[model samples]
Target: MSVLDRIIRTTTADLGARMVRIPAAELEARALMAPRRPSFAAALCAPGLSVIAEHKRRSPSRGAIRVDLELTEIVRDYERGGAAAVSVLTEERHFGGALDDLTEAAWVCGLPLLRKDFVVDRYQLLEARAAGASAVLLIVAALPIRRLEELHGAALDLGLDVLVEVHDAVELDVARSIGARIVGVNNRDLRDFSIDVERTYRLLDGMPAGALVVAESGIRGVDDARRLAAAGVDAVLVGEALMAAPDPRLACEELACACG
Candidate 1:
């Protein structure tokens, strides 16, 4: 099986187990009781190219990235460096992250939280809200068009902004069909896990007008973000680059300052 296939299989199975423990009804109740989420989509559309600094302990391609980072410390650093929003990876097996990582960050800072996870069901949306996430990622390649639309609608119903992620033109169409307002162009191909910054450029023209676009992955530094910003990107979701930097705060500051 391809890497994407494996990841989805694991996600679906894990979601099933989680459903048994907490139940969707309980998740919904918890979400209803939680405070209203901040607007993640608006954050991207702000003045200059906004920076959505991401927190992740590891990845399938590059394992164990800055696992020692305390959620509160690094997240506070991102905010201090002028990040517009924060993305916390909550995928368990491959990313070495958990929902607790998001809750902790939310507790310390007020930045809108993106629950960066391989979300396969509506249950995950409720879980995201309960964990204090202001936004959730909806990958076009992961679900069928019908399911994608369902989840997209579900996110809005829960008052969470959806970052509908697309890798190519066809997926872009799928996102558009759902009337996605916030679109993310991911540079990494989920099938083979290859990286190419041009994916964002190649898909830009296909995006709906007035949509807030975020360039994701393969953004190494300020120059990379500048190149993308010149191409009309509204925001950049950077993870691995910041995780590996000698000084994450300085690296984020440079990107945020330059992009703006």
Candidate 2:
């Protein structure tokens, strides 16, 4: 099986276990009680290229980028460095992250939090809201069009923004079909986990005009971020490079400044 297949299987298994522990009704109740989060979608559209710095512990491709840092500290560092938003990798098995990581980020920082996970079920959306996430990532390669539509609607209903991620023209059509306003173009190919920064350049012109374009993955530094900004990307989701930097706050400042 490909890496994407493995992620799907792992997510499926984890979903079952999570539901058994929290149950859907309880999760929804928690969401209903939590304070409303501001529009994470609007933050990306602010003038100049916005930065969505990521808090990722490990990945299938790269192991343990920053195992020593605390979520509260790292996310606060991102905020101090002028990140417009923060993406918390919550994929557990593959990414070595948890829902509590997002929760802690939200608790400690004022930046809008995006739950970066393979969302196959609505349960995850409720879980995210309960955990204080203001937005969630919906990968086109992970779910069928019908499922995507349902989850997209469900997330909006809960007052959470959905970053409808597309990898190609066909996926962009699916996003448009659901009226997705925030668009993320991932440079990494999910099937084989290969990355090419030019992938965003290739498909971006085809995206809907005025849709928030977020370039994800393979952001190495200020120069790479500047290239994306020049390409008209509204924001960039940088992970490994920032996480591994000797001074993450400085790294974020340099990247954001480069975008400007």
Candidate 3:
């Protein structure tokens, strides 16, 4: 099975256990109680190609990047450096992150906090809102069209913006059909965890003109950001490069400058 298939199976197993522990109504109640925060889509849609700085400790593809930095200090630095928004990786199995990371970042950083995770259920969406996430990621490769609509609707009802991610044309079509306003073209293929920065360009032509676009993965430098920006990408999601830097704050500043 592909890595994507494996994740689907694992997610199914986890979902069963998760449902037993936390009732969906309670989760929805928690989502409803939390104040609706500003969306990252609003933040990144501003003029230039914005930098969506991320807080990630590890990835299935790259392993550990920065296990040393504490969440408070890291988020504070990103905020200080003028990040358009902060993406907190909340995938525990693949990425060394937890839901608490989103809540902590939200409390510390004034920027919009996006809960970056494999959202396979509506429960996860409610969990994200309760954890203080302003936005959530919905990977097209993970969900069928029906499930995507259900989760997207749930997220919208909870006042959470969805960054629907698509690797190619078919997924983009589904996103558009489901009224996804913010579309992310991930250069990295989750199936085998392979990256090709040019993939965004290949898929850009088919994306709707008015949709907010984010170029994700393999974006390592000013030149890369500039290239994507030139192609009209609204923003970039960067993680590994920034986390690996000795001074992540300065690294973010440099990347932000590159986007300019």
TM-score of each: 0.98, 0.98, 0.96
Deviating ranges (above 4 Å) for candidate 2? none
lDDT tens digits by residue: candidate 3, 90-123: 8777788888888888787778889998889888
lDDT of 1 by residue, 1-260 (tens): 87888989999998899899997888899999999757898788789899999998888998888966688888998999999999999988888888889889889878899999888899999999998999999999999899999999999999999999998899999899999999999999988889998999989889998899999999999889999989999999999999888888998899999988
Q: Where does model 1 exceed 4 Å of error? A: none
lDDT of 1: 0.91
Error of 2 at 20 (Å): 1.1
- Return the clash pairs for model 1, or none: none
**Deviating ranges (above 4 Å) for candidate 3:** none
Better by lDDT, candidate 2 or 1:
1
Ranking by TM-score: 1, 2, 3
- In candidate 1 the C-alpha lDDT for residue 254 amounts to 92
Point out the higher-scoring one by lDDT: 2 or 3: 2
lDDT against the true structure, per candidate, is 0.91, 0.90, 0.87
lDDT of 2 by residue, 182-253 (tens): 999988988888998888899877888678999998888888887888888899999999899999999999
